[model samples]
Target: MSRVTVQLNGRDFTIGCEEGQEAYLRELAGSLDKRVSEISGQVGQIGDLRLLLMASLILVDDLKESDRKIAELEGQAQRLRHENHGAASLQAEARNELTAHLTRLAERMESFADTLEAAGDDSDGDGGVPAPDTSLAEAGA
Candidate 1:
């Protein structure tokens, strides 16, 4: 255990906490002192008990508000996760469609290449279609 001296309402008090929690205890006391100061200024030297009670209530209200905000943020995060799942499905579908289109295009290109190769094989060595024999026409000219 550890003991910490903290100032609240202009009075020093010794408080006990776990060994590693002295700093935390002091911090809480500081916050409480700040709240007490604020209330004292407004209410003009109220009793210590009343001042401490008011500060405690204020801190509890703040805690509740924080909890509410946390809950709201968690709900929003869950909704985003759900939306992302749907988006992932849509992306997969798009990928599948693109793959199918590419497959068909590849098949058509292969067929065209085969046809060109066949034509090239049938052509004469000059890489062109054979011209008609013109020997008789040239003799007349």
Candidate 2:
């Protein structure tokens, strides 16, 4: 345990805290003293107890507001994450569909090429039409 002396409302008070937390305690006391002074100035040096209570209430209210804002921001972040996940899923689905479509198109093209090859093989490489009788034409000439 560590002991720390802090001044608040122009009075010194000793507080106990963990060994390494003296500086942190002093910092908190400074903030509280500032708040108390502000309250005293506003309410014209009301009793110490009354000033302390008012300062504590104000601090609690501020804390509550901060907590509410933090929760709202967390909710917004979660919603954005969900929306992003949905968009990613949609993109993946689109990619998969495109790949499948291209695969089918490629298969159809290959089938058409095979059919043309078979037709070509049935002829003397002249598209099944005998070459015009070039020798006969030459004889006539």
Candidate 3:
């Protein structure tokens, strides 16, 4: 049962909020007051009720647009999530297929290399003579 005094467009009013939320409510009221003041010129010289109704209409119109935007954003987010799921599935399938293809290629290459080495060994006159190496390792030096 906490109440706070807020001044809106030079008029003082009381608002109720939870005990600890007075400052937040006051700030919200301050912003609303600022907006109301900014739009006062358009309210015309009509009576207070009429002016309030006009302002309320404008606020409601803005809220309607906001609601529409929220719905649009929600739809977009849902669509993005769905597309991401589809893309993830496609990527997983592509990755599996590529992995299988690479494995097969590697095995084929290994087999071909073994066959070529065997053929070269058979063609050598000095049967399978070891090649000389002049490289030196300096691990301990």
For every candidate, C-alpha RMSD to the true structure in Å: 9.8, 9.0, 6.1
Task: Provide the overall lDDT of each model, using Cα atoms, as 2-decimal numbers.
Answer: 0.86, 0.86, 0.74
The collision pairs in model 3 are none
How many clashing pairs does model 1 include?
Answer: 0
> lDDT tens string, model 2, 27-126?
9999999999998888888888888899999999999999999999999999999999999999999999999999999899778655655655566764
Worst lDDT 10-window in candidate 3:
132-141
Estimated TM-score for each candidate: 0.75, 0.83, 0.66
The candidate with the higher TM-score, 1 or 2, is 2
Candidate 3 lDDT, 92-127, residue by residue in tens: 999999999999998997786566556655665665
Model 2 bad stretches (over 4 Å): 125-141
> Best to worst by lDDT, what's the order?
2, 1, 3
